[model samples]
Target: MRKILFHLSLILLFSSCISNKRITYLQNLSDSTAIGLEEFIPFAKVDYKYILQPFDIVQIDFASSDPTLVEGFSFQRPMQQGMVGGGGGQGSDPLYMNGYSIDESGMVEIPRIGKVEIGGLTEEAAKNLVQEKINAYFKDDVYVRLRIAGIRYTTLGEFNRVGVQVIYKNRATIFDALANSGETSLLGKKNKMFLIRQYGEGTKIHQINLNDRALLGSPFYFIQPNDILYIEPMKIRQFGSADNLTASLALFGGVFASVLLIVNLVTGGI
Candidate 1:
């Protein structure tokens, strides 16, 4: 009986041991190369510049030598209580409150400039277009700045925390998305990360293998606004029938107890 129990425990332990191949990320690359990792072939020759879309919130700001001239174009709202400003304070700023949502028609109505069609344009292209209009009004002394108000994304499945995240950076990567969501849990399958992206009229899904360095060259490397990232669970997690360590241990314990009871009953004694 002792021997049976010991062997069963050993089997459970060995089954639970996850292979390094399944957990380790960027496994295809070698550290012995003389070139720095940064110098490696840049990811995605496909342009990562996100195009404007309907319902996308955009923040547009103008700076000029004369504050009064551009003041009419800016609007400010009271900062909400408990909402800290980006620079680390409760101080209010006009741009934060004055985000312009792109209408279904892909146009933003400027105060003096009227309606500007920016729907299909990249942020840089939109900026230049807006700058040209601003230039027509103010000549040389003014500068225009434009950006997506926030890079909003959602993470689901096999993550420690899953929710919609709004990142402030203009450019973010898949790694950035994972890091923001408290990173993936132990069961999160690095090789099966899925990126669901909006393309034109419909949506498309792309598989990303985080364990392979070659993923660095994929077009999906940089995350786009409104992207949905779903991290799959390792097969072991499914086989173990538990999403977490405590649950797995409890499940194992219950199975062991059941086997012990069966053994004792068969022998008519402990």
Candidate 2:
């Protein structure tokens, strides 16, 4: 019986302890080459440009010397909150309604410019296409500005906060996304996190290993709009609450004491 308890304690000690390597991010960057890990590739970082996709919302601003010329092209103004007469005013408009959504056919239907195809094009390319059409309408006097509304993403599984989040920015990195979403919990498998992203053809699943330094050179380092980040829990998490060494030792101690009490009771009866 004592021998069984000794083996059990050994098993629990080895299995329930969470290691620093499993929780740390961007490990072994300087010694990556020496450790037989993949070297950082330069071209992958240079060639990355986010392409516009269908269902994406973009804010378009048309500016001109004559305000009336661009009035029809303006989106509805979001409601301002204040005391109106004796009661409060209207609340702010929904974010989606503030910008024009790209239709299934990859076209944005403007008031006079009609439907212009901008999907599959980069942000610069899309801006140029829209600028050309605006130039034709106002004869080059009208200035057209275009940008994605926000970097919207969703976090699921093992995150401190799980749900949709939107950051009003042109571009956001994976770290930014994680930080904005309250970051992952200790039990989350940083090495096993995966990303679900949308593409022109369809959606694709990309694996992201935060524990690896090679991730810096990967395109997945930067998160795209409507991306879903899912983190699976570590397998060791199921053994017990091993978030820290103190917790693991306390849990092992409790189990050890409980077994000892049971053994004493059985021996006393015998």
Candidate 3:
């Protein structure tokens, strides 16, 4: 009896608390953590926000740059391993992780633009601004194509899935990733999520509340390139609470052993 109880306690103690993290309840979303209509929040503080960092990839096309509209803003994209393997043969197709790195001088060289400044420009702003610059040199048809070929974001928190997401869509929202990455549980404290943003040499941290309707207007609602969001878990979910579980097992073991001993004595011949 003692040996059995000892083994049971050992097994329970080592087991992980947050188990079965996958959202198998996708069939029963109502019973799941994602609930209530979320009040949307804008990306934090609308400063001339631009997520492009060194080694970022961008694609620019021309609606009509003259079959040879002066090469249409020439640029370059470097390839790398998908991180699945930093060594080689990462994939049969060899996934192309694309992006141009910002040179220490804080400029990106174009075949024509020639070392243009883009460190602090947002996707939309960068697109519009780049178009104007292109039009100046070309008088014919000049529709511009701008995209963040290697932009991404990192979501860290109570979520079942946590990782850095590479994006091609020049635009996306925070809620977008949260939903796609397996939404957080009801126990996830919505009001205190953290948004870690990098601006030049400094990084800014913002506290946000998912539960508050005011978030609809907050600038942080729209996720930016290279932004990292961390959603913290509630305090009660802390470790050591499992210790109480072991104590309960110990109590049950005592009662069972006492009862068995008493039964043995009563049935024995005097």
Candidate 4:
């Protein structure tokens, strides 16, 4: 009986040491304070302005009194005609077919407008620059709308669905990305989520704790194009507990052994 008790005590001690405290996010806030806030606090003080980069697709739409005359400025894809008795089919997305790509030289070649340097400029600034150029050609009130084709980001590490995700939106938050990718798995270390961002001539990495409300004020609250989000695996995952099956079996085995030892001691068999 003493031997069985000693083994059970050791099991409990080891289990306590392998706690999930590190995995929990935002441990500083009290449950009451976090849930009692009435008004929604703004996560970001200013709007996130995404800068243009090389290989980014830019879509420009023109609106004016005469739409037909300004059609030359917009991108158009040629419809595939039935050459061998097949009907004409729709082609790829208009944005990809006709959108302008920012070259390595930080310029986008517009039809009849020549190369315009838009790299390193925010989307709003790029739109204004393009609008100014369009005004020179058209005398009428030509409204110009410009935007990035999509916000592309990559997910790595312990995420359940890991790959490059292209979200079409003017603004996307980190939580949006996680939700879109089916949310993080149990093995994902939410406290160690890393956001890798690209800056001029270099890059910066920021660690985020998803469990903490303090992440709301973080600059990385809004994700940018080409950013990489990596969720590290929990430390416990290294010891063959990456999946529920393994953990369950281990737990069952421990309980079974404890039971066997107790029965053997009571029966005077071992």
Cα lDDT of all candidates, in order? Answer: 0.77, 0.78, 0.59, 0.74
* Candidate 2 overall lDDT versus native: 0.78
Worst 10 residues of 2 by lDDT: 83-92
Query: Model 3 segments beyond 4 Å from truth?
Result: 1-48, 51-53, 70-101, 128-142, 167-171, 185-187, 235-270
The candidate with the higher TM-score, 2 or 3, is 2
Best-to-worst TM-score order:
2, 1, 4, 3
TM-scores of all models? 0.78, 0.80, 0.55, 0.75
Q: Looking at model 4, which ten-residue stretch has the lowest summed lDDT?
A: 82-91
Instruction: Report the C-alpha displacement of residue 193, candidate 4, in angstroms.
Output: 0.9
**Of the pair 2 and 4, which is ahead by TM-score?**
2
For residue 32, give model 4's deviation from the true position in Å: 13
Count of backbone clashes, every candidate in sequence: 1, 0, 19, 3
Best by lDDT, which number?
2
Cα lDDT for residue 256, model 1?
A: 85
Which lDDT tens digits does candidate 3 get at residues 135-211? 78777867876666544677777765567665445466667767755666544556678889888667899997665
Model 1 residue runs over 4 Å out of place are: 1-13, 29-41, 80-96, 135-141, 235-244, 268-270
Give the per-residue lDDT digits (tens) of candidate 1, residues 1-270.
Answer: 767887888898787777788778766655322334666666568755578898788999888888887887876656555542232233543444568878999999888899999998898999999999988887657888999887878888887767667678878888888777877877778888889998666788998888877766778778999899898886677655335666777777788889887887887763
Off by over 4 Å in 4: 1-35, 46-48, 78-94, 239-270
